[model samples]
Target: MHLEAFLYGGVSAVLAELASYPIDTCKIRLQVQGQVTDDALTAIKYRGTLHTLMSVCSEEGFFSLYNGFRFAALRQATYGTLRFGIFFSIKRMWNDRGGTDKNLPFLIALGTTAGVTASILTTPIDRMKVLSQSTAQTRKRKIVNTFKKTHSKGGISGLYQGIWPNAKRAAAVNGAEIPCYVFVKDFLTNTLGLEDNMLTQFYCAVTASAVGICISQPFDTAKTRIMQQKTHRTDIRVYEGFFDMCRLTISNEGRRALWKGAFPAWCRNGPWNIVFYLVMERFRKFDQWANQRDHSYF
Candidate 1:
């Protein structure tokens, strides 16, 4: 079950990433737009999701929107694999140990644990993805060059920038996303007397995505700023830590800055979640069918 969960999660995540990556690029750009304190550049470059999308397409070319595609896809695969796999594995363990009634809190705890573990393990790839998509210069830079530069600045630790905020963001996202999906699906099926079909899954995924984005946006904003900040010395970063990042952003860019790129994040994650749940649900049904057929054969 764990292996199957990992496989389904990775496959769905890669496909979802491929489908929604341009929006993600736009989100990153918007999140890091006014990070610099230059008075001349204080104006927001990317006005919103549509404007950012149009600007990137026109100025940087359409393909540039997929900058750092490989890094982001890899991060999605590994992180998605572990998060989903661990969540299901732990749930199975809980069920075996007389946890027959899985409540919202129980599922949320599992999802958060899985998300934190995956986020910590894959923070470097996430850092690279953010750095690669944060600006026009980074959009053209290769991941190897980015890796070398980051390594030069802070050795191995450089690549793991923003791990704290990233992990927190993951916890928020995962805690809300998967649990909401499961809870909503169950409600639709058992309470509302709806069929467990694609329509139900679609509704559940959209709800989950919205909840995840709302909960995670502030942390996501901080993580992007911290990861994309220009640094000469690793010890002397613009934002010392997660709280420092939030404090500086609120002070310099206004409190609203904590939710920067939130719309774009929802646009990206909404489609991503829909695709992920659809694919994962299909795979699960197929696996169940296959197991049943094998048992009949035996």
Candidate 2:
């Protein structure tokens, strides 16, 4: 069961990431916009999601939208596997204990824990993905080359740069999204007497996406800026750390800058969650069917 959950989670995440990659590229570009320097080009290049997508295609070619596709897949395969597997296992344990799966607090705790645990292993992949998407790196680079460059600049520790923000973002995102999804689904099914159908799933996913994006956007911005910063000794580092980044962003760009990429993030996450949850649910059903058939054969 656990292994199946891992497989389903990874596969679902990869599929979702593929579908949402373009929007994600836009989001990252927006998040790190103007953080590279005080130059006007960097500041004004990506005006919005549509503009950013068009600008990237026109300037960097259409395929450039998937700059870090492999790293995104890698992050999903490892991070998504651990996150969903652990969350599923915990939910099953809660069920076995006769605890209601609709317990909001418990679900939030479980999801946050799962997200933080997965971030430890997946932060480097995330770092790579952010750098790949940054406008700072005008040329396309291999993931291995990116890693080597980062290591050469700051040692092994450099690979895990911005991990704190990443972990915090993950925790906030999952804590907001997963529990909200489960809770909303349960509420719709039980309280509202809605069927567990596509409509219900869509509504749940939308709600979860909105909540997750709102909670995670600020940290998401901070993480991207931190990861994409130049680490060379001679290059001026923009912000000292996570808090410093937040302070500087607020001071320079105003508080709204924290949500700079929010719309693009919604564009990425909303459909991604809808697809992920729908696929994951289907996989769960398939797994159960396969298990039942196996038991019958035995």
Candidate 3:
């Protein structure tokens, strides 16, 4: 189960989620903008990330920024824990079979595997999050109501809507994020002969955040749109699936639309990467120290 990996990943993810969630809310709001299907949502023009943050606070109150936070936190705990746990578990197995940590391909594969697995398993929470965040923030909505609405609208499939896009986004994100962080950290520490410290970790996290955001933003945009689609409205279908969403978005809004909310995503991801990797590394060091102490006692 790689319990330690799961524990560390959950803790790091929840803490990171807390720190970056407002930016995340802003990102979601931006991504859903300029979409044809968003007519059901309140029409609030957000100029940019800052504008969105300001507009949301002015109109919806400050706490509106943290709307759907419970779902976000739960999503992180389940998806984050599973992804990290599975990644490290597979990594350990591969190492036992004489695989090298220096292999970039293996790291990417592990990340993709972990991300897809986790995203699939915890998709309901993700759906609820999108539903809550993409709605008109003018009205205070309960997270439980979001769940009930989804189930009533489409049953289990409703909760699983956008799973494919979510999975792709997760795969892209984790594939880039964890591997970039690990690779950069390894290069700096092992090749450059730099000590493992906060500075080095910071550099690695920044690189990873940039790479991850670039690779995953499009899928993230698509996922948000798909999940935000009103299932109750059978008269209008905005998108059939992930590729359709991308095509329509590009055709209607231009290629740049795919990268919508990218700045806010990066803003959220930068701190998220730093916090996650820092905490993860510290947990790993503690685990190693505990193992060493136990071995010495033995």
Candidate 1's residue-wise lDDT over 21-117, tens digit each? Answer: 9999999888887764433235688899999999999998899898888898889889988998888767767766777323899989888999999
Error of 1 at 122 (Å): 0.5
Off by over 4 Å in 1: 36-41, 96-102, 137-145, 233-237, 293-298
Residue 9, model 1, lDDT: 81
Pairs in clash, predicted candidate 3: none
Best-to-worst ranking by lDDT: 3, 2, 1
Instruction: Report clashes for each candidate as comma-separated counts.
Output: 0, 0, 0
What's the lDDT for all of these models? 0.84, 0.85, 0.86
Residue-wise C-alpha lDDT for candidate 2, range 164-258, written one tens digit per residue: 98899999998899889989998999898999888899999999999999999998998898887766645455567779988888887889999
After superposition, candidate 3 runs with Cα above 4 Å error? 41-44, 138-145, 293-298
Minimal lDDT window, size 10, model 1 = 289-298
RMSD of each: 3.2, 2.9, 2.7
